[model samples]
Target: MKEGNGLQIPAGMRDLLPGVACDQRQLESRCTGLFTSWGYQEVITPTLEYLDAITIDTGEEIRDHLFQLFDRQGKILALRPEMTTPIARVVATRLRGAALPLRLCYAANVFRYEEPQAGRQREIAQAGVEMIGAATPLADAEVIALAVEAIKQSGLEDFQISLGQIEIFNGLMEELPLTVEQKSKVRTLVAKKDFVSLEELLNSYGITGAPADRILQLPTLHGGAEVLEQAAWLGVNDRARQGLENLRQVYQALASFGVSDFVALDLGVLRGFDYYTGIVFEGYTVGLGFPICGGGRYDNLLGQLGYPCPATGFALGLDRILLALARTNPPARATSAVYLIGGDDTAAMLNKATQLRSQGLSVEIDVLGRDEASLQAYAQTRGITQVQYCRQGG
Candidate 1:
C-alpha cells in the first residue's frame, strides 16, 4: 500500500462526527438510566487488562480477536474485547464477599482486532449489566426483559429477542456419535444457518435418518409457547429436557414482566461465547442484519474466575442501536433551541448568553463583532436558531 499524507485513521476505525456522537451519547444515556432504575449500579473497568486473565474462559475464537500489547515488564496486556470477562474478574477479586446477587452495570468502549463491517467495528461501545450469584430462571428472565426494555427505551419499536439455551444444543450434541471436530463443524454450520452445508457434511459422515433429522430441525424450532411443545419429543436426554424446562420457566417469567410479546422461542439460537451455560439470546431490529444486543446466562464465568457464583447478563451495541434508530426513526430535528447572541454591547451579549446557558439552553456568542446581517448569516450557516441582538441600552 502506498503511504499518502498521514490524515487517515487505521482501517476498521472511524470518527463519529458531532451530530452522530451526540446521538450515540443520548442513546447510551437512555439505556444506562434504565439499567440504574432496575437496581443495577454502574461499574467501570480498565480498557486494558492482563491478556491471560481476560481470555481465561472466552475460548480461542475470542482470544484471536484481542488487541494485544506488552507492558513495561514484558507482561502481555490486551485491550478488552468484551466487558463480561473484566466484570467477572472484578466480581471474583474485588466484590467476592460483597453479597449474593450483585447487580452491576457498565457502559464502555472495548477494542477488538477484527475485520469491521456494517454493525461490527474495531472499537465498540457497549452498555450492559451483569447479575451475579443468582441461578434462578427469574434472573435470566430479568436480563432478557431488561434487554427488551433497554432497546425499546432507545427509541427502537421494531425489534425482537430470540431466546435460546446452550444446554439444549450441548445435550443434543452429546447424544450424537460424532467426534469433537465433527461436532464443532456442526455448531458452526448451525450458527451460520447453513442447512445445506450442514446436511451435506452430516451425510458425508454416514449419519442420516432420525438422528440427522433432529439436528436439521433444531434451527427451525422458533415461535411462541407452542414451539416448546413441538420440542418435547426432541429432548430425549435429561440435559436437553432440563434446558427446555428452563426456557419454559423463563418464558413464563417474561410474560409476568410484560415483555413476552417482544420475545420468541428460537431453539437454534447460539451464542459465540464459550462461557454461556444456560439460556442465551440476541436482540435484532427490523432492517439491520446484525443483533443490536446480545447476552445470556454465564453461570460458570465467575466460577472460572475463582469465585463459584451463578450469573446472567447482556451487552447492547450502542453503534448498532444508533444505526437501527436511523433506519426506523430519524430523530426529529434538534428541537432544543440554540441561541446566538450578538450586539453593540459585549457585556450585554455575554450576560444574555450566560442567562440562557443557566436555563439549560445552548447559547453561542458572536465574538467576531459582526453586523446584524453577518451575525444572522453565521447563525443560519451553523444551524443556530433564535439569534438575539442585545444592546447597551434597549
Candidate 2:
C-alpha cells in the first residue's frame, strides 16, 4: 500500500537514526565548547544563496558539483557548496565594521551534487572558523594550531597537518613563458598528480633547464622541514624565490607557536580552490583517504566582495571527523530508557514521563496496547539496558 515511488531515501543522502544522531550531537557539542573556549563566536548563514555568489571562480571542476534550483521569484539559487564564500560575503557586507581579527565559527550542512562514496556524501555537515581582517603570519599559525587541537579534542591521537604555500605554484606560473592554454594544462596535471603528463607537457613546450626540473618535482615535493632546503636549489625566478622566503617565514612562525611537532611541509599542496592566495593546509588521519579538515589564506577574496580584507580559516568536516573518530574510538552506548506501559494508567504515565524528562532521563511509554512481553522485546531491540517500572500506586 505504498505510493508510486516506493519507500526509499534518495542517493548520496541519509537519515541519521537515534544512535548515530546522538553520537553526532555529542561530537558537535564537544567541538562547540572547544571553539568557544578559544574565543571564537558562533554565527549562522543561510543554507541557500544566489547561485552566482557561491560559484565565482570556485573552480571549473566544482561548478557542476553544486546543487542548484530556481526560487519562487525566478532567481537562480544554490545550496551552498562550501561555507567560505558565504562567510566572506557576510564579513564584507554586514560585519564590515567589526573589529580586526574577527573570529567566527559555524556548524552547518553543505550540499553538493556528486557521486556518493563510502564516507563522502553530497549533503554533509561542516564545522569551521573564519578569522577576518588579520594578515599576519601569526594568524595563520593560530588557525593551524586550532585545527590540531580540535582533532585532538575529538579523540584522534595519530594525525598530521600537511602545510603548503600556494605562492609556490603562483611563482612558477609567473615565471613560465607558456601560453594561457599551456598554463591551464599544467595546473590540471599538477592537481591530478600526473607527473608523466607534466613532463610530457614541459617537453612539448620545448622548455628545459633547472627551473623546469624543479617545477616538474613539485608534485612529489612534500615531507619534513628539510624539503624546504632542497626546494631552494630548484632555480626559481626572483618572484618565485620571494614566495619561498614567505613560506619560510610562515613555517618559522608556526614553530614559534610550539605546534611544530604536528606540522609537515609540502611544497606541492596547491589546494584545488582557486581563491587561495597564500598558505594552504589539510588535516589527515592514518586510516582516512581524504582530509578531515582543510583551509587556507584568501587575501584577495574579500576584495572581490568589495571590502578588500585579508582573512584565513579552516573548516572541519563534522561527519568525516565523526567517522574517523568512530573508527578509532567508538562512541559510548546511550543510556537506558524508563518505559511506562498500559493504557489504563495513561495519565499517571504522562506525569511520570514528564518528571523523568525534567530530570534529564530518557523515558518512553507504550501507546500501542502491546503486552509486557512485546514491550520488553521492543526495549531490548532499542538497546535500552535498563527499564524502570512505574505503577499507579507507586
Candidate 3:
C-alpha cells in the first residue's frame, strides 16, 4: 500500500489504543457481573441486518444515522445503529417459543453516521439487557431499579434517571381530532422543549383556558412524586387519565422497591427514537450533553417482527460512560503486563509466556529483531511493568 497525502481516518470514527481498550473491557466486565446477578442471560446478535428486517415507523430518525451499503444481492443493508431493534427481531424470530419472562443481556459495538462531539462518536460500544414477556407495573419498576443499581455499580454516583410516559402525549392526541402531520409536529415540539411553538400550535387549534393551560403544561410536567399529582390535577382526558394512572402505578411499584430516590418524572421527555411505545426513560450525568443510558417499554415492537411478546430494555453507552468517568476520576493506571525478550531462546520465551498466560497474566514475547533497549522502550511505552530476559541453556 502506498501512503497518500492527508490520508486519515474518518472524523467520527476513533481507534481505541491498548490502554483504552483495557479500560473498556473492565467496564464491560463489571456491567456483565451486575446483569448476571440479576438473572439476565447473555445473547449475541449480528452487526449487519437487511434494512427491511429492522425497519419501523420510528426508524426514519434512525435511518439518517445508519451506515448503509448495498449487499451482493443488491439489497440495502445497514450497520446496526442500536441493539434494541435487533434484539426485538431475535425475540420475534429465534426465541419466539422461549419461556415467558425471558431475560437477556448483550455487549456490542453499534455504528451510526453522525457528526462526532465530545463523548459522542460514530462507533460506540454498549452493554444492555432486555426483559421480555412481562408487562406488569412491577416488571417496569424492577427494570428501572436494576438500571439504578447498574449505574451505582459502574462507579457513577452523581446521576439521575429521568422517567416519562409516551402515553401522556399519545393520550392527548387521542382526544383531539388532529391529522398525523399535526401530531408529528406536536411530537417534534415536545421533544425539542419548544414551549412557544407548542403554545402556538395548541392556541391555533382554538384550544384555550383550562384546555390550553393543560396542554402547555405538558413540557413542564416533571419533578418528583408531586409531578404525578399535578399531572392528575390538569384534567387529563380519558386517554391521558389512563396514562397517568399507569404512571402512578409504576411509581408506587418503584417506591416499594426503594429506588424512587434516583428517579424523576418528565412528561415532556419525547426521545427521538420512534419505536418507543410506552414508558420511556434516560439516565443523565450533569456534565454530559447526552444521556449515558436509555431504553423504554416497546410492547408493540416485537409484534412488528412477527412475535407479539411485550418487552422493555435499556442500553448503557459504554464508551460515553467511560469518557464521563475518565473526566471525573481519570482512568486508573493500566495493570502491569509481562514482556519476555529473547533471541536464540525464542522457544523458551514462548513457553514461559504461555505459562504466564495460564496463570492469568497478560504476557507478550518479542518476535521482531529489535534490540534489548528497543524492547525495553516498547514495554515501557505500553505500561508494561516487568521484562524477563530468556536465554538458551542458561
* Candidate 1: Cα lDDT at 50: 94
Error of 1 at 177 (Å): 3.1
Report the error of model 1 at residue 149, Å. Answer: 0.8
- Put down candidate 2 lDDT per residue, 19-114, tens digits, no spaces: 788777777888878888998999899999998888765777678898889989999999998999999999888998998889988888998888
Best model per lDDT:
1
Whose TM-score is higher: candidate 2's or candidate 3's? 2
Query: Per-residue lDDT of 137-219 in model 3, one digit per residue for the tens?
Result: 88888888888888887888889998988888887777677787777788888877799988898788776777667667888
Q: Model 3: how far is 306 from its true place, Å?
A: 2.4
Q: Tell me the whole-model lDDT of each prediction, alpha carbons only.
A: 0.89, 0.82, 0.83
Off by over 4 Å in 2: 1-6, 335-352, 366-377
TM-score for all predictions?
Answer: 0.96, 0.90, 0.89
lDDT of 1 by residue, 1-394 (tens): 5589477888778899878888888888998899999999999999999998999878778888888999889999999999999999999999989978899999999998889888888999999999999999999999999999998888889899999888888888888888977887898888778899989999998879988888898889999999999888778799999999999999999999999999999988888888889999999888888888999999888888889899999999999998888888887546334888999998888888889999998887888888899998988877777999987787
Worst 10 residues of 3 by lDDT: 335-344
Supply every candidate's count of residue pairs whose N, Cα or C atoms clash at under 3 angstroms.
0, 0, 0
